[model samples]
Target: MSKVVLITGGSSGIGKSIGEFLTQKGFIVYGTSRNPENYPDSQFSLLPLDVKDVKTIEKTVSTIIEKEGKIDVVINNAGAGITGPIEETPEAEIKANFETNFYGPINVIKTVLPQMRIQNSGLIINITSIAGYMGLPYRAIYSASKGALELVTEAFRMELKGFNINMTNVAPGDFATNIAAGRYHVPLNEVSPYLKPYGNTLDLMNAHVDSGSDPNMMAKAIFKIMNTKNPKVHYKVGAFMQKFSIVLKRILPDTVYEKLLMNHYKL
Candidate 1:
């Protein structure tokens, strides 16, 4: 039987491209979207799912299990981006960020773990971000959310080792995706100190993505991760600068890393 793969946020961008690429590679790929119709033409199956809603998550996974009988791999790729200064961001927005980027993936993981455990063999690939390691300036909440998931991924990997279930984090750098168009931004008026810099930095970041690496590279990286006998805890997928920055963040002092970030993002 072909390996059954489930990916979140498969309607467009990285998620969608990965699903398509995997299907071409002969995997039975199923993808998720809040609006299934929006991705009706995708090569892979598009299922409706809202990561924040337990019922929707369970139903989607159940539907896949019923049809495929087994889920060999799951890519927790469903997430959104939010941008703003820490102070200006509302409590609700921060919670929403965690809801989509953090808790959302957890919901799916919990739902699938039971089955993966029963099978005694499976892979859980988390599409994390470079920001998860080094928090970005304006995208504070987004970084925090991904960082939290990275911790969970680490702990879960240790706990699930005995079950033959593999867990890994695939941190993709800025890829040329439609995420920039859909990213959420906090409303900053004249009173906000961050209003001016926010616009300039966000635009620059968007352009960086526009000129960033190909989403196909991300898909290829994930393909390698999926087939590895025992994948490592974390893998960085992106350009030289992004990968180097992640490496530098690990070895560099906090002050030095912060300075690098400030200069790179023009903060």
Candidate 2:
């Protein structure tokens, strides 16, 4: 039988590539995006959805279930980025970021879990980031939201272990995606004095994003994970440096790693 897969934020970037790739591989793929018109109709069915809205999530899942009868996989890839020091970021901005990046996936999972549990088999892939593991200088709020998401991913993995459900977290490094271009920013003028020193780091972050790994590579990694008989809990995808960074952080002392990161950013 063909596997049925649903992907959120699947109009473009990594999500779109994954949906296209999976569709070509013979999976019955459905992709959701806020702007459903942006998705190509020939490749995969497009559903209108805003991950931040619970009603939208519930309706989308209901429609998919009604059409397909069974959902084999759900990829929570709809998320946004906020770039600014935490102090400079307004509470409203922080809440909005969390609503999209953190709560959005949580809501989707909650809506889908009941059906998955009854079926006793399902795969969930969360497209998180390396920021989930470590904090960066400028994107404090973004990092926090991802960190929270990672924790949720871990918890779900353990909780769902006995239910015959699988959860995988893809922690990708900086990728050449529209995320950088679409990132929300707040003016530093209104922030507390404590956040002033991080301005230079934010500039460097923006520059680094322009030269990050290709989104296609990340999509390929996700494809491989989805096809696995038994996928691991976490997979990191990026350049050699990113792989090395994760390794170095694991082995190096806190002070040593901090120094390396600071030097790398010229801080």
Which number leads on TM-score?
1
* Candidate maximizing lDDT: 1
lDDT by residue for model 1 (1-267), tens: 999999999999999889989999999999999999876678989999999999999999999999989999999999999988888888998998899999999999999999998899999999889888877889989999999999999999999999999999998889999888887888767888888888778888889889988899999988988879989998988988888987798899999989988887777
RMSD (Å) per prediction: 1.1, 2.1
Worst 10 residues of 1 by lDDT: 186-195
lDDT computed for candidate 2: 0.85
What C-alpha lDDT values do all the predictions have?
0.90, 0.85
* lDDT, candidate 2, 138-178, per-residue tens: 77788899889888888889999898999988988887777
TM-score of each model, paired residue for residue? 0.97, 0.92
Clashing pairs in 2: none
